[model samples]
Target chain A: MERSTIDLWVGIFVALGVAALLGLAMKVGNLTTSNIGATYTVTANFENIGGLKPRAPVKSAGVVVGRVSEIKFDATTFEAVVSLSVDKRYVFPKDTFASIFTAGLLGEQYIGLEAGGDDAKLQNGDKIIKTQDAVVLEKMISQFLYNKAAETPKAPETSGSTSSVVDALGANPLDNTTVNTTINTLDNKGKTDIAQPVAP
Target chain B: MIRSKLLTSAIRTLRNIGSRFTERIWRMGAGARLFGLIVVSSGECLRRPRLVVREVYFTGVMSLIIILVSAFFVGMVLGLQGYNTLQTYGSSEAIGVLVALSLVRELGPVITALLFAGRAGTAITAEIGLMKATEQLSAMEMMAVSPIARVLAPRFWAGVIAMPILAALFCMVGVLGGYLVAVPLIGVDAGAFWSQMQASVDWQHDILNGMFKSVVFGVACTIIAIFEGYDAPPTAEGVSRATTRTVVTSSLVVLGLDFILTSFMINI
Candidate 1:
């Protein structure tokens, strides 16, 4: 090929490489959506951010409007500080609430902003006072297990006749002895199970 | 008696293979010295820019079509596999994440390197080996021109640069192929596919690490091919032997390096 033609092909090759890089960055990697037109930065603090990394999409009403720009830990508050950039086109009220949501249940996490009905508009460097942290599945599972185990001790309180019935029925849903007592006493088991609220 | 004889023959064959592998490693070490010399002489490439362009046009531009086509097929297969497996979990939407991760992180670089070794690496060795067999390198040396600077360095740099670019293109094409299969054929939601993919794949971790692997493979493959060609005995049989060695050895090196690089990049 001629040198000029080679040069043109080389340019095309470089452009293709750059396009690939951009695709990887934008389509495969949720890099900041800041450069589309204009954007404003806002900060939020959360107690926990489970696997919520930078470049995670910031969605509002199930629509992506921005991205998480930076994440840092504040020693004084002991909270994870996340900076988000929202597009200028999509405006949010001052009382907008932000929560971390997981995509596809087990997939990557992103921030979901719930719009509030407020007259004031959130501007640059605006700090969102209301923020919810990422819900850790492991912690939730552990809590569930602990609650189950704790309810077992309350089961011994079931055999105290009416008082036991009251304690077991009133206190925990896991203890099934209360239902047995009701079955024995009321002679109408199905009605009792329906009448008593299962305390969990 | 026959069992013992068979065992002894097996042991002998294994020993011979082991010894040959060690001998190849020794030759590779010697060849690596040529790599060092080529690195030092690469400044000559900038001075003779046309030579680099020619070599790049040959190795990189020539290999582009095959690289793109193979990557597309590989990606389509990945999409089908991911869809079938993920549909069992009721989360076929994550297909884009699966396809992108597989292509960008591992398949793109490794497969591209293997294809490049077969295509460009063999050609470089054959071309240089033929030149050596014809006493062209000798004539250049006799004319007080350094063959390493004039011939090997340009081609070496070209291959090295071409590799990462080709691998990147392969990944891009692979993503499109995946999109075609996942969105239309499998009936996955287009929004979820791209959104999940974008959320999951890290720009620094997956994409950069893949590019880094391709660059290393590129350097290793091109160096091995050129060295084998330059060191081949001046004969037709010797040139063919060198070309074969280049393919096998470059492939082995690329795979081995890939393993080492993966362990370091992923684990650490």
Candidate 2:
């Protein structure tokens, strides 16, 4: 090839390389969005993030509406604070629940936003009050094994109340004033230690 | 008596072959030596951009057509195979995910490097082997210049840079080829194909990792090719044997490295 021909070919080669990389970033990487649009940030704190990482997809009804921009640990609160940058096109309700979900049974984790019936729109920098942690397979398996081992074949309690088992599960006296107040309404509130782990 | 004599000869031949193999193993090159060479050549790479660019044009641009054509065919094959399998599950649209994941995570880098080894890598080995045979490298040494810097570094570095770029091109073209087969031939919805891929693939994890894998393959193939050529006995037969060695050795190394790299990139 001549000098100009070589240069042109080289240019084309470099361009194709870049195009392929961008194509990869777009098609196979879920990096299509430049994050350079009319977007707002909202925070959600979870007890455990599991394998969730920054820039993991934030999906609503399985549609990617945003990205997880940041993940940080709050030492005092003992929670994972995740900041999501949602597009302006999708406005979420105030009572929206954000849950960390695995892509499959044991895949990369992402944030799944479940919109609530509330009419109020979440504003920038607003915090999502209700959040669920990741369904860690390891923890669930271990808990299952522990529960199986602890099944003692004891006779039914005299109260005939599931709360009787809850009382035996070592219900925290301080838990009533803290997180997961919804669990307290159920008679078997103490059974939630295996379901929803308390922050250590 | 005849059977016993034949068995003894066979055993002697086996011992001879075993000793030769052991000798080759004992003469294996050191990592410290390769590292030193890379350090020297990498510095030369930094000093001379024009030389590197020229070599890249030769090594990379020349292989474009073969890479594209092969990748397109491979992608088409993947589309057909993946569609056939997934259609049984009533999820043909997810063929996009299958094709993209296979190409980005495995096939694209591995196949492109394999092709590159056959094409530019052997060419590089032969060219350097010929130079060594003709005493061009020796002539450069006589002129008080380092042939390692002038002759070897730029070409070696160019091969390293070009491999990843070529692999990327292969991936892009392959995805298009897959789309063409899936959408037009198989009647898969384009939206589902792309959307499913978008939802599942991770940029930093899948795509970038594939690129990194290609870069590493490039360095390995080029080093093997150049080293074999430079070390070849200075003759026409030597050059030819060196070229053959470059192709076979690099192919095996690429496969082995691919397994190691895949283990690191993916979780079981």
Candidate 3:
């Protein structure tokens, strides 16, 4: 190939490559969405962050206002200290509630900020005190089971008059007592089974 | 007598293995020295921009068609397969994330490097090897010309410049192919497909890491090709063997380096 022809092709090749890179950055990557300008850093402590990663979105009212910049474990408090870089354009009250929330049933976690009624605005490096930790599925399921077990034995006791009615009608008073006793024992067993795993 | 013969054979095999191992180590040292020389004399390639441009034209522009075509096919296949699997979980929208992440993080750089090794790398080895066989390198030396500066540096710089661009093109094209299959063919929600991809694929993590990997692969592939050529015996058979070695060595090095780079780059 001639010198000019080779140069022209190389030029075209380089241009195409640059264009492709630009396209990737703009369309396929998070450059457009996560480019929150002029960010101010704030930190919040959480008991558990679950799967919340650094660079996860920090949103207010479903709009991304910042991103989680750093996640450090506070050894003294045994809590996760998460630093969020919120866009300077948006400000929160000092008492803003920062809660880790999942987008869907099985999705990545992000921080959601709910503004609180405070006279003073939050400054950079200020810690948000009212923070909610990520909800672990195992804990939630165990809690539900515990509540069910606690409520189960109470149901029969609340309807004690009905059981008494069975006795008044002379329809197997021993059977009624036995059924109530069995249910109470089963409920206690269920409570112990569910509570043991969660105690730690 | 049979037992003594067997012992002799075993000893000969051991000697052969030892010699081959030491030869490999010596070759590695020589390759490293050549790489250093290329870096030192790379100023010539920059000074004469036309030489590098010509080499880029040969290595990069020529290989574009293969890179683009394979990328498109790979993307379409990923889209079809990812959608098939993800839809079963009722998360077909995440097909975009799967396709984009796989292509940007792993496939784009790796597949492009493999193809470049097959195409441009082999060609570089064969051409330089042939020139050596024809005594062109010695002729240049007799005329007080440094072949490393005059010949190898431009090709080295060209490969380095062209590789990341090719990989980027591969990624862009691959994503488009995936989009085509997902949005129009498979009837995925177009908005969800793009939005999910954008949300998951971070620029610094996914894109830049991929670019870095391609640059590393480029250096490795080009150096292996030039080294194999420069070290080959001045014979047709030797040149042919060097060409084969270029493809095999480049592919292995690219894969091994990719694993190391991924381990470092991925944040757990």
Worst 10 residues of 2 chain B by lDDT: B26-35
Fnat scores for every prediction = 0.61, 0.83, 1.00
Indicate the TM-score of model 2. Answer: 0.70
The DockQ ranking, best first, is 3, 2, 1
**Candidate 2 on B114-188: residue-level lDDT in tens?**
999999999999988999989999999999877878778888888888999999989888989999999998899
TM-score for chain A in each prediction? 0.64, 0.64, 0.74
Proportion of true contacts reproduced by candidate 1: 0.61
Which candidate leads in TM-score?
A: 3
Per-residue lDDT of candidate 1, residues B1-268 (tens digit) = 9999999999999999999999878886889799999999888899878888878888998898999999899989999999899999988998999999999988999899999989999999999999988889899999999999999999999998899999998998999999999999978999999887976787787889999999999999999899999888888999899989888888888889999999998742
Q: Which candidate tops lDDT? A: 3
Better of 2 and 3 by TM-score: 3
Tens digits of per-residue lDDT, candidate 2, A76-139, equal 9999999999999999999999999888665678899999999999999999999999987889
Q: Show model 2 residue runs off by greater than 4 Å.
A: A1-4, A34-57, A61-111, A115-200, B1-35, B41-47
**Which predicted model would earn the best DockQ?**
3
Arrange candidates, best lDDT first: 3, 1, 2
In model 3, the runs with Cα more than 4 Å from the true position are A1-3, A154-200
